[model samples]
Target chain A: AQSVTQPDARVTVSEGASLQLRCKYSYSGTPYLFWYVQYPRQGLQLLLKYYSGDPVVQGVNGFEAEFIKSNSSFHLRKASVHWSDSAVYFCAVMSNTGYQNFYFGKGTSLTVIP
Target chain B: EAGVTQSPRYAVLQEGQAVSFWCDPISGHDTLYWYQQPRDQGPQLLVYFRDEAVIDNSQLPSDRFSAVRPKGTNSTLKIQSAKQGDTATYLCASTPGTLYFGAGTRLSVL
Candidate 1:
């Protein structure tokens, strides 16, 4: 079963501090990993995605993720947090299959303090 | 160019009632997907269609949930009998390349 696991349920950081949200996935073959963020009362927006080639991918809002095949991880990172960055972040994975069925993790809630 | 659209933004119903959610995908998207997002959880794939043909619906609750993408454009998801457990945000997404989601319809069954 292909699944994404976001070990942290909630993370709190002070504004301007570095932030990291961990994500681990369980899949047999190559994985198409993505990070999505949802603000309050808003739809989910794509942060970034990794298909192949480069392991480190940059996303919108100064966010980036490194896909480590050996660790089965694709953790999201930001150099400095902002108050507006407080939202729910989800990690998803899809296989190279034709269907493109996406599996998402429970999500991690980030709270930024000013 | 407009993004995916869904309505009604919110819906409340009693158990055993029937409700349908509508989705209008992006102008030329070939793929459309419906997802259910429970509170504090990730969005789960309910069903998906590729130009009027169901690409996959294995995760959909076949007994009560049914979806249709007539004319390969607009789509609808119907719940024959609503249940409290079905309360969640119903998300509609379309993609020609990368996926773009709608505002989502929040359903609550009491």
Candidate 2:
């Protein structure tokens, strides 16, 4: 069975501070990874996705994620976070099979303090 | 183009009551998914369809939860004898290279 693990339940950082959210996955074959963000009262929006090629994928709002094959991790990062960046972030993974049913992590709540 | 849309954004019902939620996917999307998200938790896939054919539904509570995408565009999910454990936000999503989610229907069972 495929599963995603997001270690942090909540993270607080000051404005302009760099941030990193950890995500790990357990799957048998190659995985299609994705990062999604949800703002207050809004739906989950796709931030970025990694299927192949570049290990580092860039997303909206200056967000980026690096897929590490050895560690089975796809960690989301930002050079600087703003107060508006406060949202719940989720990491999801899908199998390479055509089915491509995605499994999501518990999500990490980010709070940017001004 | 409009994104995935869901109806009845909020609902409150007593335990043992019934409720239903609806979803309309993007114009050209062939894949539609339904997920259940509890407060402060990740969204869990309940069922999905691909052009009127069920792709996966292993996670759905078969006894009381049922979903269908008959025409492959609009979909409905119904829960009979709703329970407190079924109280959660029901989200509808469509896949077009990526998944686009609805704002979700928040269900509260008293």
Candidate 3:
């Protein structure tokens, strides 16, 4: 089966601090990866996705993720985080070679302190 | 374009009660998915449809849970007998390129 692991349950960082949320995946074949963010009382929003080509993918709100094939990781990163960036972050793997299959990890709660 | 939309944003019910949630996907999207998100956890896929045809429903609780997308534009998920374990936020999403989500129907079973 395919699964995603988010090592951190919660992460706190000072405002304007750089942030990195770790994610690892277990899949046999090539995997399609995605990062999603859920704000308070809002739905999960797509931050970014990686299917092929560039290993580094840019997303909304100054977020980016690098897919390290050797490690089977797609880690989300930001140069600086704002208080408004506090949200639950999820890393997902698309199981199907097709465009449909999606499996999500237990999210990492990110708190940006002012 | 409008994002995926779900109805009855909040639902409160007693155990054994029945409830249904609805979803309307983006205008031209071909895929729709239903997910169950327990508090403080990531959303788990329950079922999905590829234009009114069920592509995957392996995780859905077949005994009491049912989902359908008859016309291929909108979808509904119903629970015949709600239980405490069913108390979770039900999220609906559609895929154009990436998944667009609805705010979700938060269910509380007492």
TM-score of chain A of each: 0.98, 0.98, 0.96
How accurate locally, in lDDT, is each candidate? 0.94, 0.94, 0.94
Estimate the TM-score for candidate 2.
0.98
- Per residue, candidate 2 scores C-alpha lDDT tens digits across B10-37 of 9999999999999999999999999999
Per-residue lDDT of model 3, residues B11-102, tens digit only? 99999999999999999999999999999999999999999999999999999999999999999999999999999999999985678899
Q: Could you tell me which residue pairs clash in candidate 2? A: none
- TM-score, predicted candidate 3 vs. hidden true structure: 0.97
Ranking by DockQ: 2, 3, 1
Clashing pairs in 1: none
Model 2 over residues A3-102: C-alpha lDDT tens digits?
9999999999999999999999999988999999998777799999999999999999999999999999999999999999999999999877887588
TM-score of chain B of each: 0.98, 0.98, 0.98
Write candidate 3's Cα lDDT for A20-107 as tens digits.
9999999988888999999988899999999899999999999999999999999999999999999999999986566477889999
Residue A110 C-alpha lDDT in model 3: 100
Report per-candidate DockQ. 0.79, 0.84, 0.79
